[model samples]
Target: MIRKMELKDREAFVAMANEFYHSDAVLHSIPESNIEKTFDELMAGSPYIDGYIFECDGEKAGYSLLSITYSNEAGGLVVWVEEIYILPKFQGRGIGKEYMDFVEEAYKDKAARIRLEVEEENERAIKIYEKKGYRQLDYLQMYKGK
Candidate 1:
């Protein structure tokens, strides 16, 4: 089942997000401090973000975070899929699609476009996003050092 996230899911969400961010694959876990602050901000109810948690038989299994932003170029709201993940054991079982469908339903009236980024080398994720109708962007995503 997929449902809106609640405060109680914080710890699990953080663990999962850290796992996703800190490693290229599912293993080689990193120390908590590496992602603690960002996780805390999400838990604090960051205004532009909403989280959806996936549950299996009443236990938290995975999560996705969506961030909505207004795009002057699109002339409407755009949804930036900040993060979407399924535990390795739960992947390839249609849960990720369901979670995405849920997001589509949830934002049906609010956005003109939905966007997400995948590592160029991550073929599985690229295929999944393509199957979901996302296309290559005209520009690259660049960042400045902190």
Candidate 2:
């Protein structure tokens, strides 16, 4: 089951987030600096971000953090799948497909398009997304951080 993230799910969020990014040496051993406040605010709910916790067989399995925005091109709300993390042990069991399907049902009426990005080298993830009908865009992603 996929449900709205609660402040009480902070530990799960932190754990899954770190595990998901474990390959990034820079963040491997780092603690989340604002997860407490972040989870609190997110659980409070808003028009912007939507965070969900996925449970499998009555246990915490993973999460999906989404960002929503209006897009003239999309002709409705566009949502970015900022992150989706499933515990290593829970992977390769079709849980991801179910989780994504849940997201679609939850936002179908409110969103025009759902999108996500994967690391260029993560071939497994790329294949999964492709199998789910996601395609690569011709545009490059450019970003600036302060």
Candidate 3:
């Protein structure tokens, strides 16, 4: 099931975030020293950011973090999927598709667009995205390097 993360989920969230971030397939890993502090500062139950926890039979199975933004171009709210991770054992159970379906329905009326980025090398993820009808956009994502 899909539900907004609650305070009680903090420890679980942190652990999952850490595990997902450090996986060899994950190209974007936060500094080892700042994980907790960074999560606290930016994701401490902020309204602008929605962290969704996925559960199966009451067990924490995965999570997806989404951020809302005001896009003048869209002239409305836009949603971005910051990160999505399903635990190792739970992989290939259609959980990711279910999560995307939940996200699509949740934002159907409120968001002008929903966006996510995937690494070129993550072929499994790419297939899921393509099957879900997501198309590659022309614009590239850029960030100011440290």
Candidate 4:
């Protein structure tokens, strides 16, 4: 099952997030401070962000973070799937596809597009995403962060 993240989920969420950032799934590790800040932002009821915790047999299995933004090119609201991480033990059980389905169903009416970024080297994830009908965007993504 997947549900909105709550304050009580902090410990598990942090552990999983830290693992995710440090694993091959990501390009680099982020400071733990950033993880804490993300939790705080999610808990603060921010309108632009949403967090969900995935459960398997009543155990915390993983988490996903999503961000919302308006895109003129997309002609409406865009739902950016910022992060998705499943515990190592639960990795092959089709949960990722379930999460994708959930996101699609949840935003079908409100969003013009559902977007996400995947590391080019992460071939496994790329296959799953491609099977789910996600296509690569040709433009290079760049950001200037403070």
List the global CA lDDT of all models: 0.78, 0.80, 0.83, 0.95
lDDT of 3 by residue, 1-146 (tens): 88887767778888888888988557867764555664564556666788888998679998888889989888899999888989988889989999988999999999998889888888998898899899999996688965
Which stretches of candidate 4 lie above 4 Å from their native place?
Answer: none
Which ranking of candidates, highest TM-score first?
Answer: 4, 3, 2, 1
Indicate which candidate wins on TM-score: 4
Task: Write candidate 1's Cα lDDT for 1-146 as tens digits.
Answer: 99877777778888888778665634345566745665566678786877788987677778887887999998899999877888887877788777778888888898988888777777887887788888998896677953
Tens digit of lDDT per residue, candidate 2, span 1-146? Answer: 88888878988898777776566412234446655555666877877888989888889988888989999998999988878888877888887888778878888999999988877777887887888889899888687951
How good is model 2 by TM-score? 0.87
Using all chains and alpha carbons, the TM-scores for the candidates as numbered come to: 0.84, 0.87, 0.88, 0.97
RMSD of each: 2.8, 2.5, 2.0, 0.9
Candidate that beats the other on lDDT, 1 or 2, i.e. the better one: 2
Compared with the true structure, the alpha-carbon lDDT of candidate 4 equals 0.95
Candidate 4 local lDDT, 94-132, one digit each (tens): 999999999999999999999999988989899999999
On lDDT, the leading prediction is: 4
Task: Name the weakest run of 10 consecutive residues (lDDT summed) in model 3.
Answer: 32-41
The per-residue C-alpha lDDT of model 3 at residue 8 equals 79
